[model samples]
Target: MMAQWHPIAPGEPLRAGDQGPRIAQLRKLLQMFGDYNGHPGPVTANNNNPERFDAGLQLAVESYQRRHGMAVTGVADKATLKELERPPVDLARQLEVNAKRWDKLPDKPGKRYILVNVPDFRLHLIEQHRVVLSMKTVVGKSSKRTPDMTSKVVSVVFNPTWTVPRSILLTDLLPKARNNPEAMHRRGYRVVKYGTNTTTPISDKSIQSAARGKATLRQISGPGNTLGRVKFIVPNKQAIFLHDTQAQSLFEHHHRAFSHGCIRLQQPEELAYALLGPQGWDRTRVAQATTGDESITIKVANPPKLFIAYFTAWVDGLGKVHFRPDIYHRDN
Candidate 1:
């Protein structure tokens, strides 16, 4: 009696050295996804050498990991292998979804603009035809998600005042104030009560007494400020813009989507320089702007168009299809 063998289907995803009529079809698909625009190459069939994977295939896997902010070990571990084995059909579907989203982006080109890709956790400064600077970024959390919209750079605030949002004040600061009232004062926050129906303001002393025993106090600016040292204002209803974060350690992670509802730039000064141009402002000047006596706005001579887009699948400069995890679940 002979053992039975299963027949492989055409157009199915292939592992290394998966030979048959389907091999050609699989190879072509692999080529399409392999190194084209700084993307990784495809895996090769070298079954004889169990100790080492093919050079080209290993390179491709490593490149993919690097781009997605994954651990860059050349060996195809379980996670790497799983990603490598993603079906072509699935990849095509993601590409289509992202393409539709890209279509909705603004076509206008400003003299200088900042483009932030939320899922990719990166910000690109596009001036003329080139990307002036590229850096890692942290976007809004899933709950307080950063909205996808466009706006112009109104002004750059140096040593800006941090106004606490009602949401943060109620959920985060209030709880903390309950724990320790001095803690709020130590952090440069002043509590205030406002009229329920009107925009009537309350005095600092009144707010202090109102929140004496209760933990419903609001904090203002200082080193513990959520907005860090500086904030870049954009005229939008979303009340979103690029700002510095105290949690700098998050930037080291590849996928840094951990903000409340704003975009956090890893290197804000670099972006400022690129946006401000010619009129050079050093770190001291930037620091002054962020922490000066009052908030100041520096208007650009010709502001560049800012586009905050979400693209999970794209063909890199090398023509290879680069697929990233739909971190925001925007594809669905």
Candidate 2:
């Protein structure tokens, strides 16, 4: 059955009234994924208008979207295309590969656990087997793939300063800083001596020296901060954690693998409140901590355990099958 399937690579969404070979491609994909029961019907029929997008096909698309954790718009959108464009053989391979991953999971994850499935670009807060909270996440780019690990969100830092990582300095910002030192300062950056917090303000001359690798730079906490207003410190060797992002607009895109190595949350405040509320932190206090220039780090005495998993395919507790694109090509 998989051998008879072909890939569907539409450049745009296919709605209810669309027609052409793309529609047939859509139907065949939906059929291949078990979304449509009229397999041998539409696929095998010799009708002259087999490429028409009828209402039944639209319903099938919605079913596929809903099961795959996507917006059920009844249109073949990019997220849907990312899944359907894959040949059936690859998807089957994902199931077999992910099954081994699923087996490694502990039978009892805990009363509460944070699950960040990298390929799915989503974070779910599970409490007693119920998904009490879920949100969109921007994960590491392909070049710096987010690693799978176990850790605890040990602290929540409010109004955190962005200490520019050394790799990012050389690879991303050094050229731009050399181009315009003043603009770099205007962008909330300060050239400071490496490994020490210099209290005095730095000069433009220092910016050039910093760009030339004489020193390091850090972004002050202010408007448009790189770490946004908050940072969740999940302790692991990789130094990866979940945090708010200044580029909140990135959450609106369907494909959200854009971070360097951390997971950027769409609704970080919600997660923050969830984590700190039990520790007697109210929303008013939380909001206040996030404001102002001073950085505050609150230690979590009982932090929630975090599990970052990489699964291209898995079945949700609700029995809905979910498959994601092999963005890092790990599904061998």
Candidate 3:
């Protein structure tokens, strides 16, 4: 049976120095989640030895923080306490929900494919059912969620231009541009005729006309480009594709869900080199393509299948079950 424990009282956060029945409780709860496995039984060695928060427990707290996408400060802050307060999900229930989702995957997703686990904020490049590469990814925000779908990655574009989506242009960009008219030129953006090569200087009339579908706006290829150094094209109906980003500090956060709809990659070049294969694409070639302010495209000889999937919980190869928050609230 699970060990009986008292409730942790609300107060200041628990750090490494504090010790009491609450410390013992924290140890027990962390153990339940597989983040703490230091000793068998209670933390107290004996009545005289009472519970004491130490380095071992601190390490466990950090592990819990990492898994939950919280700041890895190794301290039991209010946020950490709040997460611990929630009743732990039964292991059987987690497995059941994950199993149902796993059943939907293809029996064989080709010899090469990319698996994006939305809730986990991770990307796994698989070859022959084995993970060859894994990287952190910034997914869509809760308001603009990344959809689940299967597509094929066909090409890699270096020094890519950013075409401000009509929706974003109207809702987000235009409003900001209105306040700062020079925002267009300063950000390497230009107003132009939709689907045409002819370019015109930015003006109030053009901006107003673009809002009415009479013109289009796109950012020039440069360092300021929001798409960063490269983009991986995955033809999908949602107009979503994987690409590099200028705002890379987001990766430092354990929980990375700060994009409009497209997924932002941490190490996109590694993926580009892998997908390009040996035919002619390599580190040196990729560097040359993205080195300057020129748009370049390299078509892969064989495109890898892309699978954007969702699963809140799963057991890893080591038999340890991992769980993630249902950011999209699709589990209910």
Candidate 4:
């Protein structure tokens, strides 16, 4: 039966007031998924008013998009239509995945711990198994997907310098630097030899070699740093950590999976305070620490447990089933 749910032909999204057979199919699908109750807006002779993409149907479509972690545009977008066409994976499969994750969860994930749900693009501060705070998060894209790992947040660095990753430098920055000799300096980057402690000015020829993975480039800690004003350090081999981004406007979008690999926090200051308040850190202290060009790192005696997890579908506390897109296509 699921085999027949093929994607509609590529075209502009079906917005409100649009009436067609595609809208009819969408209405049926929404009703099947419990998003459409078929009430409060309009009533036709046949009861199931499928042809019209009215306000009620638009609301249901938005709700479906929200549950599936898609862009909640209230229109039948290409991505949304594609998602509608894809066959739903069985509940048993989702339950199996959730069970494994539950088994791996620590007995006491610390008195205060941070939970980052990769697929949900959300971060929650859990204290005693109850969420005390929640915020939006921008995770990595499909190509450079954010990984699932458990670690402890040991420290927070303010005015942090961004060390250009070898992968990014080799692929993105090196080529740009080769063309413009002053590119690195203009972008607040300082070049250094990989092994030695010597930091020197970057020459045009040196930039070419660096492109070939020969040297290291580190950005200076300042207003325009990619790491923003602060970052949370979790000791991991993958070199992944939580940090702030200068682009705060991205958070306005519903589907925000735009990053290299590190998780981008929507409210970095609030998160810092949540983790550091126990250590006598406050807004005033954070401001002082972040005032200079130098990076300030503060150690946490009782670091919070950090769990980066991915769950495409799960049952909420109220027993409502919530489904999200397999953004990384991990659930084969």
Q: In model 1, where do residues sit more than 4 Å from their true spots?
A: 1-32, 35-51, 67-69, 193-222, 280-284, 287-294
| C-alpha TM-score for every candidate | 0.77, 0.83, 0.88, 0.81
Compared with the true structure, what per-residue lDDT tens digits does model 4 show for residues 1-332?
Answer: 35534445556678988878878778877776778866564676644556878878888988888777777789888788777765655645866776677677778777788889998899999888789889999999988989999998999999998778998888787766667758668877777667755666678766755666667787889888888999999999999999989999989978788998899999988888888887898888877776778888888778988999998877777665677767888777
Clashing pairs in 2: none
Per-residue lDDT tens digits for candidate 1, residues 1-332, read: 01221222434433444446544332333345553222234434543332333444455556666755467775445665456556656767888998888788757666567788888888888777577799988998888888887777766765565656667776776666657656667776665445322222234454455445432344344567667766788888877888877899998786677888899888887677666655677666765666644656687656666788888877766575566778778898
Winning model by lDDT = 3
Clashes of 3: 0
Winner by lDDT between candidate 3 and candidate 1: 3
User: Predictions ranked by TM-score, top down?
Assistant: 3, 2, 4, 1
Instruction: List the candidate 3 regions with Cα displacement exceeding 4 Å.
Output: 1-11, 39-50, 89-95
| Deviation from native of the Cα of residue 71 in model 4, angstroms | 2.3
lDDT of 4: 0.81
lDDT of each candidate versus the true structure? 0.65, 0.81, 0.83, 0.81
Best by TM-score: 3
Answer with 3 or 4, whichever has the higher lDDT.
3
In candidate 2, stretches whose alpha carbon ends up further than 4 angstroms from where it belongs are 1-14, 18-34, 37-52, 66-73, 76-88, 199-214
For TM-score, candidate 1 versus 2, the one ahead is 2
| Evaluation by TM-score, superior candidate among 1 and 3 | 3
Instruction: Tell me how candidate 2 scores on lDDT.
Output: 0.81
